[model samples]
Target: MQLHSSGVQYKLHLCLSVTLELILKILELKLMVVIMIKDWNVMDLVCTCVTTLLLVLICLLLYFISVYPENCGSYHGPHSINCLITIWEEVGCKIKGLRYPGVLTNADANTLKIMNLRNVKANMESVKSAADGGNADQQLNCYGIAIPNTCDSHNGPHSVECLTSIWESKGCLSEGTKAPVKLNTAEKEALALLNLE
Candidate 1:
């Protein structure tokens, strides 16, 4: 996915700076209220404290209302300020819409396509017939040659399981070429980029 421009980061920083300034001002105001109440009786002190706290709450509410849209996007669902803050910290800005489950990256989407093709090929009538008969070796070789080529044709990297399937289907196991349960660093990284790890 294309990343948003640096304006997002700039706005985030601006919001944070504004929030910090507000907090400092609120602290100063609280200190002033406490200091200005020198001769206040117990009830007066209680009322002053309550009024100061309500003012602070109102200021914070207004501050959140001002920044919520820029930071939280158009999500209408119930959400906490803490959730918005967490999204800002983790993802730079609002996600823009409802984040459905099982969100996939581009590579992951391609891998899933390849996987669907592989599944169809593996479950074909010819392969089923070969399995039923004594032509398993022939079928295996055909798939071993076809599957990897199909994956490459789609420009998708193979996972460890795909590599192992290819190796075994090519009769490498019978020829004493042990199948690998893991791939090398570069191959693993390629698969990881597709989220097939």
Candidate 2:
């Protein structure tokens, strides 16, 4: 069996517990409704009313907690909540379209989950293959133009630092004869390719 982190286990346990509590509360409400309809006694009515009010308060609190979770603060809260609600609405629509939809179905969820796992596996394999190839030299080509290096470095000839050295070689430097000189074609092309233009 796959091992889960403590945090994940805790969250799953809490969710199941909450769902069970909500289900029991719903059953209790239904029973209370039936009792109230059968007997119109003052005491029974008051007790039923109090129970229903409490149940409503609990459900409302649960709704808020579900919509605005702790991690909601890390994201755009209202936008995230709207996105979640939209997804839930789509699921609700699917449920309504089912032939004999008495139970919630995870057919779509399971399919999408399997697809996501396959995609992740594919990506991991590709990353592993690239790592196996060893660190090859990355020759930077800027817009069909090659930037020549005047000084040697690990980043090869196309690096901006190496390009600066090339510029200095061409008398483009401070306290020199051509201090504030314009860039040559190669330097300009390199900058353009590097998106520093």
Per-model TM values vs. the true structure: 0.26, 0.22
Q: Model 1 misses residue 118 by how many Å?
A: 28
- Give every collision pair in model 2: none
Look at candidate 2 and tell me the lDDT of residue 196.
Answer: 16
Please give the RMSD of candidate 1 to the true structure: 16.3
lDDT of 1 by residue, 47-152 (tens): 6655666676666544444333233332332433333334322432112212211233555334333433223223333443442244534334222223333233
- In angstroms, the error of model 2 at 157 is 60
Candidate 1, poorest ten consecutive residues by summed lDDT: 92-101
Highest lDDT model number: 1
lDDT of candidate model 1 versus the reference: 0.42
For each candidate, the alpha-carbon lDDT, in order, equals 0.42, 0.40
